[model samples]
Target: MQCSYFDAGLCRSCTLLDTPYAEQLTSKQARVEELLDAHSPEWLSPIASPEQGFRNKAKMVVGGTAAAPTLGILDGRGEGVDIRGCALHLAPIHDALPVLARFITLTGLQPYDVPSRRGDLKYVLVTANAEGELLVRFVVRSEDVVSRLRRHLAALQETLPNAVVVTANLLPEHKAVTEGEREIVLTSRDRLTMTLAGMRLELRPQSFFQTNTPVADQLYTQARTWVDELGPASVWDLYCGVGGFALACAAPGRAVLGVETSVDAVLSARATARREGLDDVRFEAGDATEAALQAQPGEHPDVVIVNPPRRGIGETLARWLDASGVQHVVYSSCNPVTLVRDLEWMPGFRMRRARALDMFPHTTHLEVVTLLERVDSPATDRPRVRMP
Candidate 1:
């Protein structure tokens, strides 16, 4: 993939684009192997996929002028470089850039200047699934430009009828995060629905779904297979964002409980479960680690699925899991370093299967899922360990 924009110094966000995609995958695989060797060698495996145009979400910085809005990286001095047609985005996003830019210009929306911090529109986030339906959210500093935004919304809907959801996020304060306190729906509906792995997920403006929807489908399918093979009587999904794993494992007789911290995500999960008519699936909003600790022995889970943040599970959670009488565990992590670190403390648990899902292409980030099972006896066939 030869990127002329990158070569001309227009944007260096994807610094590895100069290198061959195969070489990049090899390097990342080696890094994962080294981390596993030094920590949990049994979990190491060679799992690499394509690394081109796989990102399903685009978060572009608005800069330059409203007439010619630039979409790309922000420089160290807080300047935006125009690379909207870069090779990393999906084909639809690349094709829609010029049209969106022209619409922004015609609507007279002011592009936010980071250094000066004196504009209404801060950023524009666009998300699309495999089906090509788009969900757009505009992060604005204030809601003073309602009339202008309303006009632009009409124009955008006419131009792109496939846009399922359009929202405006108002952030009156100066913050780096893309979210805000108030979200106003510019469209008739408040949610955008997408299908993944035979399940429908409802996405709001600020909801945190996986960026790579296709690979996310594969990841969830693999997790479901692992759970089914284990024949778990009951399962607990910790840090379950929107209950992806919980809903996948839900069956007629099996019970699955999903625990998450975000109230919106819990509501979405419960709604999905109800829509699918899965009576055995349930979701709750609370501290995942605390819920796990407070679970009574009689309600001991047969399997526990943990999909933690980049930092991985904390020491307290790991200790509690080790003492818990769970027979099987599934761990999904975006950071392999933390995953390996946590696996060292789990006793009598051996790795059964491991897979890598290419979630963020053209970047160093990857998602990994590992299944672990407990050994019944003290003396058993332990797997061989190799150091990197």
Candidate 2:
């Protein structure tokens, strides 16, 4: 779990690297309980993540020269730190980093210089699944290097045969963003398949997937277990990125609808649904709040699963859910501070059970999933089990 980058102060992304792994998990569990203990809900044991080689994705900034490109974060001076050997990345990602760096040289693609803003490539994004297949993306300033990338892609693929998907993303602006609107496919394959809990999840280039693949599976499995215990006939997954939770909860008779804003993600989700022959499960590209607010009483689901951003669900959606009178809600949040704020809006619902998942280890970040029930719902109330 030791990171040379952290010890040398080259990269402090893992702020808690100095602390022991046991202490990190203990601190995270203590913090989450302090935030939610007032609700007096049953607490499940916190899920711990692997200490090293867990991240499935690497968003390395392209810096330095084309002859010797650096694949890592930029220093305060806007120069690359060359952290290709970062311990957080999975084996496939670590192996592909050197190949990608070599590809930059072979393609003669200039790495973007932050202060000067006079280069073609900005970032090299690489994502790998459990199967060892990879999706490589080069974020460039323009289409100026598209021809070079396409021409030498075969040469790069020779070294990294597991690179099934390759793409180029244009970020024409002089801003600090990672990608742009236009994307060009460099390989025949356009999607990467990530298998979790006996289900295959396809991911388009822009589709969002968890960086920690193993921990993500645990997260989805926990959600599925809770949903099965509740046995809701109909469920709505808001902000459903690639339909991970929605697909996980899908049953023969259950109707699951996933709402997401990204069309690519929706397409990926739909493809997976078709492959699995889950006709009752569906996905649509739309805003979560709008879809929730537009749902009529008859269209209301028996359960609503919300995996909102760090901002939580916001007051508007929170207030709507408060008055919607839904029987149950499964809320997954990365920020408990915002989660507590959203809980304040839903006074009609009470937390039944909650668990913290350590999605991001070596840092203060964590994910908490809470099952909420309407205060006056007809379901029989079970006594809350105390946690150790």
Candidate 3:
């Protein structure tokens, strides 16, 4: 997709924008195939993403005046760079940005000045699902603006009809984080539901959900398919964001436990489970590494699924999982560098199949999912199918 921002040299977030979309996917697939050669020969073609208008979430740093606030990235010298109609954001996010801009004027709120640090508004974060339902959060200096925003909440919500949830986050100190410690929900409903593969996954403002909603569904579906083939009696999902994988893989007799650090994500996951009548799956709030090591005797997982951060599972967790009795491991990684590092720790496990999902089309980012089986397991003895 052509972007005026790129033409004007205003934003180069999509570094690969100059390259053709087809070649971009090929490059991503080639990178993974080179790095994970011995790990998994069986492969699936990279699930390509749209050239533009695919991002489900839009985080625009609040800059300039509230009346004429800029919503985009900060410049090198810490100045607001306005990129309102960024092609990467989905239609709902693009449509709500102007409404949010207008709301700032109606509320008479002042956008924070990065240099003076005097204004109240700090950011405008908007997340949308496939159905175009939106969750809008205004990040501000403190709770002082919360009261003012509450008065104008109705008008804002009315202007942006798709906005199902609205919230305010406070950041008292000067920092790099876009969000703050305290979150105040301005709307009655705080959770947004994303329906994928016949399952509803609820996500809060603070919960982690993929920016590319369609590609995320494909990612979850492929992982669930692999888990179904293995048919493990008990499964553990580490860093389970809103229990997408855990809930999708939940079977009649199987028990699925999802461990995540975010209380909000775990709560949303639990609520969705109750709402969907999936009692076999449960989500808990805790550090994934600690939770994995602390599983009770009867609660041992037959298999473990890990979707670690870009750093991948650190040395400690990787070494622990290497010796853990879990027979199979499914790892979903956004960074191949860290993925290779973690793979070095797993001596007994061998990668069975690997696939790259092109979640970010015009960027270098790629999501690679791999299925691993213990060396001595009967499953590993089967001849691995070769990839094209």
Candidate 4:
């Protein structure tokens, strides 16, 4: 898992690259346990990910001149440090990066110069699905370079046949953002299919999907196993990006509803449900907190699945879930600090079981999923437990 970029100090994204992979996983699991030891829940063995060639997505900052473009992150001087062969990216992404760099040259798409803010292209975002299909996006300052990209799209596709979905995202501002509001499809196909845990999840241009394919599969499979064991009749997936958790939990008689703020993501989720013939599963585009608060009188779910961003659902949603009368909650969080804060908000619930999934290998970040059971009722009440 050696990275020349890390050694040369050109890119230090993987801060723990010096540490052994096994040690990294162990330290991450230990840190999570130390943070959640108060809950005293049963701890499942931590899931491990490959130290290298595991990242399915490559977010390379477009730099250098368009004629000789660099595909990687910007340096301290805001110039691109070429990492086309970064070890973290999957094979497809690693192979396609140089081709994409050439495409930039062919189209004469100027790399956005951060210091001067004079160029057109900002970033090249490439994603690879489990089937080896690719979705390529070019984030630019405006539509000024759209014509060039569209005109040469066929040649680029012919060279990179695996590129199924190609789009140009217009980020007109000079701000430091990944993408913008308007996404123009350069190819006939608009969505890329990610088959995870036996679910054909459609991915729109702006849709969210886990970067680590194998680890993401393990996460969904673990959640599905938990839901099956619990056998909840109805489940609500909050902040459901592309309905991964919701679709994973859907069953014969089970009703699953997924709520997300992104309309594109909601549309992708619904399409997946329809393609799978999941009549009982539905998706809505709205704020998760508002959707939860506006649930009909008899629409309370038996189980709720929340996979929030690093913020960990915030206090408002946490407090609402605390009093929602939901029997159980499956909480997946990427930040243990925020997760502990949210857990403190739900004093009436007890963490029954928890597991750590090393989705971001060679880094301090980790993903943890916990089963929270409402133990306020006498029938379900149990003494606080401790892990020996």
Candidate 5:
């Protein structure tokens, strides 16, 4: 995808901007093959995203003055690069950005100046659902401007009619993270609801969701299809952010449980299951790897589904899965390098099939989903003859 920000020598996030879309897919598939061919040589055609305007979230840095605020990355010299018209964001984000800038201008909210260590507004995060509805959050250094921004909420809402939830996050310290420990809700409703893969899910400001909606849908659909074919009696989803996989895999007789470290994400997942009356699915807030080791007899899962972060599921979990009696494992990884590192421990299982999803376009980042099955023991099946 062509980007004006990249053209003007501003944002260099998209490393493969000049590469053709087809070649980009080929390169990603080849990288995965190089890493995983030993375990799983079978592959499927990589799922591709549209060349432009597929991003459903925008995290724009609040820079410059409120009167003339900039919505993009900041330079080392503390100057802002105006990327409000970036082609990666969806139409709603592109449309709401000018309104958001105007809101900042009208509210007299000062953009946080990193050099001076002053100002209130530091970042503006906006997320869009399938219906183009938006959830906007303003990350500020303190609560000094919360009342002012809340006072002019109507004007911001008037500018962007699709905005359903608006929140104010306070970051009291000079830290690298965008969010803080305390979250002050500015909207009457606490959740932003959306539909994906034929399931309705409610999301909070802090909860994690895929940035690309179409590819995320494809990812969930592919996982659900595989699980449905397996028809496992029980499934455990590890690192289940908001229970995306568990919700899709839950069936009438199947028992599904999702474990996440974030309480907010666990709460969101439970709320979704409760809202849908999914009695067979549940979620817990805790470290998944430790919890799985102590899982009760009744709660033990036959098939395990893991959607781990960039680091992959560390050695402990890999060794546990390798020795566990579980018959099948569904692994979804964002980092192929770490994935291969963890896969080496699972010598007992063989990769049945693998597919790549182009979750982030104009970049090298890709999501891979693989299904692994434990090979039957020789004692369990009688062989006609042994090669000698």
Candidate 6:
């Protein structure tokens, strides 16, 4: 992966240029193993994935002159460095960069200046599915540039017919989040839909989806296989963004409840279920920990699937699951440190299996899926084996 963009000092976002891809993967796998062995040995796995350009979404920082806009990492002093041809993005996105940049210039929308905070457009985030359909979201400082964005949308549609959905996110605040409280639809619809393993997933501008679509499909398929193999009577998907896990486990005569904090995500999940005619699966908007605690005793699920953020399952949620009658838990974590920490809190649960999915390549990050099963009963004294 010879990246001239980085050589020319145009982008420094990927700091792993000096390291080989194989070495990076090995180092990450070793780090994960060490963390799990020292903390939660049972969750350790030796498997790893090959490193490559696995990014599915691109969040470029817009800066420099609009006529010659730069898209890439911010400098040490906070200036956008051009990286339109980054190595981490998929080939399609990389191939489409020049045209996209031309469209941006043709539209005459000014790129937001972080220091001055004057421009209307902050960033242009583009998400592409496995099937090559693109969803474009323009993060703007305010709705003042609606006309500029509209003109840009028309040109983008003409220039890049593959762009399926386009929308404008109004972020008037000076916060770090690219999105704002309000979103204005610049296209025919306010949402973009993608299909994964025969299931449809609706994506809002702010909704969370795995950036790497190929590995994400593998992750979802693995989770589905595990759920089906367990054959649980009921399932509870906590932190179920857009019902990824819930929809994966949908089957006849099996009831699955998905709980998420995002109301829009829950609504999208429900819409997908309705479209698929999957009456057994439903989604609700609420804090996952609170939802789990409030679940009726009789309605307690036999299996629980939690894909929490980097913070991992907090102490409160861990305690709730410790007391709950749930028999199985499939934990998908992006942070190994937090995952091991949470596993230490629940000693009653024994690790059954684990696998590392390389979702973000060219970086140190790794996604781990762990299956933990509750011990039916406590047994008397036994020798404890030290972790390697």
Query: Where does candidate 4 stray beyond 4 Å?
Result: 297-299, 378-388
Q: lDDT per model, in order?
A: 0.77, 0.90, 0.86, 0.90, 0.86, 0.77
Q: Write the per-residue lDDT of candidate 6 for residues 1-388, one digit (tens) a residue.
A: 5678667776655567667867776787777777766434354343444344567788888777779987766787767788877767776677666777777788777888777777777888888766777777878877778888786677788878877878888887777886787778788866668677567798776778888777788788888998999998788899999999999998888888898998878888888889889988988889988986666553457789999999998998887776666678999999988888897778778778777776766667889888889985533232221111
- Write the residue-wise lDDT of candidate 1 on 301-384 in tens digits: 778999999999878888777766677889998998888888877866777767766666567887888888886443233222
Which scores greater on TM-score, model 2 or model 5?
2
Return whichever of 5 and 6 wins on TM-score. 5
- TM-score of the candidate numbered 2? 0.96
Task: Tell me which of candidates 1 and 6 scores higher on TM-score.
Answer: 6
The runs of at least 3 residues in candidate 1 whose Cα sits more than 4 Å from the true structure, single-residue gaps closed, are 38-47, 376-388
Please list all clashing residue pairs in model 5, or write none if there are none: none
Query: For candidate 3, what is the lDDT?
Result: 0.86
lDDT of 3 by residue, 1-388 (tens): 7899998999999999999999999999998899998775599778988888888899998777767878888888778899999988989899889888889888888988878778898899999887899999999887877999999888877788889899999887888888977889988898898877678788888999888877888999999999999988888899998898898899998888898999999999999999879888888899988986665433347788999989898988887777666788999999988999898998888898999999888899999999988885333333221111
TM-score of 6: 0.90
Model 6 Cα RMSD, 1 decimal: 5.6
TM-score of 3: 0.95
Kindly list the per-residue Cα lDDT of model 5 for residues 100-163, writing each as its tens digit: 9989999998898888888889899999887889999999987877999889999888888889
lDDT of 6 at 121: 74
Higher-ranked by TM-score: 4 or 6: 4
Q: 178-271 in candidate 2: lDDT tens per residue?
A: 8888889989999999988778999999998988877888889989999999998888999999999999999988889999999999999999
True-vs-predicted CA distance for residue 65, candidate 2, Å:
0.5
**Each candidate's TM vs. the true structure?**
0.90, 0.96, 0.95, 0.96, 0.94, 0.90
